[model samples]
Target: MGNEKETPEERRERMRQRELSNPSSSGHGSNLSDLVGGLGWKGTGLLILLIITGFVVYSLATGN
Candidate 1:
């Protein structure tokens, strides 16, 4: 069975079933560190960029 090839839909359904059977394994209840770690370097960089942009916009709006 391990050697058998699964179609994309089949694989997706299998994964869905696995997640349903093990809710904790889906990472929905993970901590902040785990969530950030899962985002990888590029995602972390983009998040930092967004935060800096928001700060700049707020500062400009407040004229401070």
Candidate 2:
């Protein structure tokens, strides 16, 4: 029977099982905050770049 139809409960159960199987890639966007701690190195680089850019702009504007 290739044209099988699943009931509502069956569909829900299937979705739950799929989520439990792959918890990391479950199409959830709520874990993006977890990336903040993981970006330690990148965050430091970004801060350095911002500071350098600000200094350059200030020096150029003030002729220092």
Candidate 3:
């Protein structure tokens, strides 16, 4: 029944409350947003892209 439309700020507050209320949340430190500056899964993809591009550029520059 708590499916009412919540603004982004409200949604974040609700989630923050839930995490604070749950003791087990402590073990999982630094959720995805905090770890990636709020980039979440997109950050993972971007990081992979950067690594691959770097390797390609390095090989081409060194003629290897």
Whichever of 1 and 3 has more TM-score, that candidate is 1
Candidate 1's residue-wise lDDT over 25-53, tens digit each? 96578777776799999998898899999
Comparing 1 with 2 on TM-score, the higher-scoring candidate is 1
By TM-score, how accurate is candidate 1?
Answer: 0.50
lDDT per residue (tens digit) for residues 1-64 in model 3: 5657778899899888998899586797677667677776788789879989999999999999
Tens-place lDDT per residue, model 2, 1-64, is 4226878888889878988788767667556455656669788678679889999999999999
Q: Is candidate 2 or candidate 3 better by TM-score?
A: 3
Specify the highest-TM-score model's number: 1
**Superior candidate under lDDT, 2 versus 3:** 3
TM-score per prediction, in order, is: 0.50, 0.39, 0.40
TM-score of 2: 0.39
Error of 2 at 33 (Å): 20
Off by over 4 Å in 2: 1-39
- Which stretch of 10 consecutive residues in model 2 shows the poorest summed lDDT? 29-38
What is the descending TM-score order?
Answer: 1, 3, 2
